[model samples]
Target chain A: MIKADYNVFDTTHDTQYIYRKLLDCMARPGKIQSIQSVTRKLNDFPDGLSTLLAIALTLVDREVSYHLISDQSNRVHNYLKWKTFSEQASIENTDYLFINQNLGEDKIYQLMSLVKKGTLEDPHQSATIILHVDELSIDQNKRQAFHLSGPGINGVTTCYVKGLPIAWIKQRQIINSEYPIGVDFILTTTAGEIMAIPRTTVIERKEE
Target chain B: MGYVAVTGGRTAIENANKLVHSYRLKDAERAIEVKEIESQMRLLVDRVMGEGGLYAPEYAALALKQTEGDVHEAAFLLRAYRSTLPRNHYSMITDPGEMRGIRRISSSFKDIPGGQVLGPTYDYTHRLLNFDLRNESGAVEQFLEDFALELDTEMDTPSFPKVMDLLREQGLVANRKIDEVEPFDITREKLAFPAPRSARLQLLSRGETGAMTALAYSSMRGYGAVHPTIGELRVGYSEVHIPYPFADEEEDSIYIGELKLTEVETVNSFTQNNQGDVEFMLGYGLTFGQNEVKAIAMAILERSLETQGQSPTQDEEFVLLHIDSVEAQGFVSHLKLPHYITFQSMLDRIRQAQKESKVETGSKG
Candidate 1:
């Protein structure tokens, strides 16, 4: 069904815009950027699917494989495969993993633990996880704040994200503890905002 | 003096572009059609296509005309255009053995099976320029009409068996095991050193004609030990097919179209295998269109890179990195861009050195 609706999305200019945004966010970790203009064109699709799909369409292709962890039906998985022509692979073998917000904390931990961190010689061969969260903001009022400090951050910066369990961050820390061999994360929200936490970025949660 | 960036050159740049357009059409002659370039300048189009790594003849012709016959620029345009396109389907592995050969030849054996078909080549012809071609519009039609009468249209086109198969049957040529692993795509991934054979072949196939030829020549001229015999050189059309998306069977595929390609397989000197059996090594080259020289050069360079030698051709990094038309041309052309700051810094260093030398001379006085 999404394949039939693909004509609404401009593969050229739209993907180019999304790619630039993705690149910007990836370079500056935890910096929230929005692709609301492009995703607005796909309003007919379900919430959060459009934003995730936009990112997937920009990055995934036949050369790469992706794994989707969603409590929702297999529709999103089938749509991604058909649209991008990227194969669906197991967690360890997949180059990308798309985790939906509906997944439980234990499921997220298991998925994160299994994702490939890649070997020292080929750190870039690691998986990139695209997770859908409820919301992301720089204003740290009420929401849990994450202290982001690394290659992209100047000294230290704070990113407040809602609905991302502490378990996921803990698991990510364990997996990425070994330098240069860790998975990158691209967090997207239903409102079409996106942020990146590359392997080089160190994320620390500020307890209340 | 501090370097300052030059500004307000927008109008000048625009005028310069207009001047270039005017220069292309100052003669006021009838515009040469894209189709004419595609058909008449067939070899040129083929060269651009091979280097550009895109097979569209019409696009290649348009690129040639747009760049005013600059081969490197034309190929660069095509490669840039290629980047914007999305990869939809991966074609099934094409076999050159099934090619409908228009021209096939072998220099390895004196009289091998599927004897050499010398189809449309000037290898034996004199190099003298044809004065008659200057105003031969009438002669072209007349020649075509006369040439058509000699052909037997009823005969089904002949397909030839590979020359390497004969050597392979006798175990004179080393038998390579079928590698089922998916080939590395250079476009998708950054090429790392000690590259896989797939990446090497991809880079070589799309390499610039003159650059590859020079390196291959260097190898043949005793810089390296890869003076290989042309085991088989075939120029022909090869069909491309993609697996049917809805098909349940593996064999079901849709025939997309055919591409004109020149394939070369070279036979090098023999060496002992792991089993201690002596066998000749094979070098392969294939390109988009009928570019015989590039393909042959590719074959030579392919073999040369595999061999351990001190020659430039034998060094994989040197040959592979230099052969890319876009990369080489872009880097060389970039020197023309504004480098005021860098140049100024260098000037400051030189002036400082000169001042120090003068002080030393005064002290001596």
Candidate 2:
């Protein structure tokens, strides 16, 4: 049950606009879009959480299920269920998995592996993973720089994403190698910039 | 001048809307009430409700009036309105067998336990328009009086047993194992390919009537292999049930009024189940109101698409994606929206191609 104060503010217009941004990000992988936080008054969450919460409100509903991997308390889970009306699913069975920056390399690896790789017949049955981070940059000097080349990217797009485990880029490659059966990702930063990396995108780790 | 600006068309847009309203109300006749439209143009109302994916007659009628009888526009308005509403609770699985039958018939059997009740239908009626109704003032009152008199004697007895139960008893129909799987709501999420049966049914139920009929006709006309016999066609009101709030298994569900639904259970050719036993497959369809044609078409199309065959009707994406009136209307009507940049680019490309061709021809000359 959701608290009375937990409100999905202006679900018709704001939520739809946020979804459009999410769709655009998904369609053009590596393209960052801003999702304005409308329900910031509800909870004074951590830095990058407002956007994640907004996304939960926009996309998650009772028909769908989500699993939260956050450093925040179980309040986030209750808030999501209450506001979005989405069912709380296990890590293996979730449609959307929210992964905050707190998870270590080992936990990320284990969770990524456990994430549902939908069957060949129904590739869309796979989970969409939303990772919340501090910032996203395209600076070459960054340690977490990635070279992406795939369906959405023109030729090769190199970018830096903060708040993921250093080994995550390689881990994503391994998980998504089978084509179509892998989980898609939307990485949101504290600055309100969100970038998507679908399963079709090939993510290569760029050494500093 | 055609204004394209950051701040323009405020007054022009306002007048343009006024212009539309003026056009809609141009007739100097008496103002048409929504209730009149709801009762008189019931088929149209039903079509709009089905396509709109909402079952509100008053709303559908108002939408029709607002859109000036444009089916797609009316449906779009209803759909847009529906998007603003919050979902309270999902109705429990409704059994069509429990429908208080107004009109019930089965094409497969000569006679059933519940005899055919061909209640007020146009099936046998001549297509000629009644010119007498044009000047008729007390037509509505007289019709109601006659209907009231008829209903006094002709009210159907309780418990209209379903025709399918007879087949089930004889083991002709496929054994239906009751599963507790929740039906997917197609309105909430984007429909993915190889969609579940529940999602497919939901989409088909809300699909445009004409689109569904055309597709079903194509299948019958040899595009796909499905020749269905309507096991039962029922049009009546069914009670909508929702789980009692915070109630346990012992608690009876809550009844949230009744909705008029058209239901069809089509029996297609027998096919072997996974166990290699011959069992007749049933295609089911139910939609809002007295929409028999669409319901029948939907039942046939539902069966045709269930096999997931390569044929046009069998292909889920081709049938399901195209049948949605709102989606079809939006995609088709969006062309009317300003595409200035795209048009300019296309013009540039055409001119560029022409220039290149001319250059080649000039050099050859």
TM-score of each: 0.87, 0.67
lDDT of 1 by residue, A138-182 (tens): 986848899999997899999999988888788888889998999
Error of 2 at B241 (Å): 1.2
**How well does candidate 1 score on lDDT at residue B192?**
92
C-alpha DockQ for predicted model 2? 0.10
lDDT of 1 by residue, B236-347 (tens): 9899999976566988999999999999999999999999999999999999889999999999999888889788898999999999999999999989978878989899
Candidate 2 CAPRI category: incorrect
DockQ of each: 0.49, 0.10
How does each model score on lDDT?
0.89, 0.84
The residue ranges of model 1 lying beyond 4 angstroms of the native Cα positions read A1-7, A20-45, A118-123, A135-161, A177-181, A193-208, B1-11, B139-144, B147-155, B175-178, B272-278, B359-365
- Model 2: CA > 4 A from native: A1-208, B1-10, B154-157, B175-179, B248-250, B273-277, B308-310
Model 2 lDDT tens row, A69-173: 777748887777566656689989999988775777888889888888898888888888888876787766666777888887899998887767766676777
Query: Number of clashes in model 1?
Result: 0
Tens-place lDDT per residue, model 2, B1-365, is: 45453456689989999999999888748778999999999989998999999999999999999998999999999999999776756888778788888889899998988788887699999999999877988987888887997777766545479898888888778836766787777887777898988899999999999999999999999899888999999998889998764454735689998988999999999988888879898988899999999999999999998775667999999999999999998999888877777788899999999999999999999
Q: Could you give the interface RMSD of each candidate, to one decimal?
A: 1.5, 3.3
